[model samples]
Target: MNVAENEIKSVMDKYRKFAVYGLSPDPTKPSHYVPLYMRDHGWEMVGTYPKPHEANGFTIYKSLTEIPKEYRKFIDVFRASEKIPEVVDEAIALGGVEVLWLQLGIHHAAAEAKAEKAGIKVVSNRCLIIEHKKWF
Candidate 1:
């Protein structure tokens, strides 16, 4: 279920809680700030990173599997393309994941296909913050 470019906004509107993979600790980084912006806008966000880190006091999972199943509805991925497949696979295994979103400059066709095939809405290479700004 690859979401068309124009439908991204509608998709964004549909989900409230988001699990951001590769979310950074640095406030200046896109992975951090993008989710932060969403959080500030009344969106609920949790984060997962390779290392232990905090994003505005939110519990940052060390891996996707660590996230609670109910919080996996929308996954906004900030990982590089090379790392996406594993994340996508984990998302699928986690279940209840409605959307798989790859952040700006990150795109993995295989991963996208896998998620789409699993009936998860897929959006690639788009900045969530930029998209949110347009619709919110």
Candidate 2:
């Protein structure tokens, strides 16, 4: 479940759909800008946040569970590192999540273990948008 070079590209190529948890309305925020960047990079992004009904001019859902059963493979988490335990638990419950991404500066060993145990590929303390750009 740990990420490797091949796994990263496989997720991007196979599952272009993404749910951005904690997506923000403010452009200045990392949560807001990362998803926007992904959308611009050709990834279909779903804003999953409680505060914003819309982000980057697209409607935002409250959680991954709210997203239709079909789109769950791509998930990028922007929650605090300390809160990752709860977030990871939620992701495990939300079926079909292929990639569990933790944004830059976020890391939780216990949550990472749980996600891996659930057979979910995890990328911790990394930036997906940045990685995409770098690879391209």
Q: Choose the strongest candidate by TM-score.
A: 1
lDDT scores in order = 0.85, 0.80
Clashing pairs in 1: none
**Model 1 TM-score relative to the real fold:** 0.92
Candidate 1 at 114: error in angstroms? 1.4
lDDT of 2 by residue, 10-91 (tens): 6667767777888888889999888778778887877778764666586688777887655567678889999999988888
Which candidate should be chosen as best, given lDDT against the real structure? 1
Error of 1 at 27 (Å): 1.6
Q: Across residues 1-136, which tens digit of lDDT does each residue of candidate 1 receive? A: 3898789878888888889888899998998889878888888888888799767877898887888876689998888799888988888888889999888899988888988998998988888888888877
* Superposition TM-score, candidate 2 onto the true structure: 0.91
TM-score of each: 0.92, 0.91
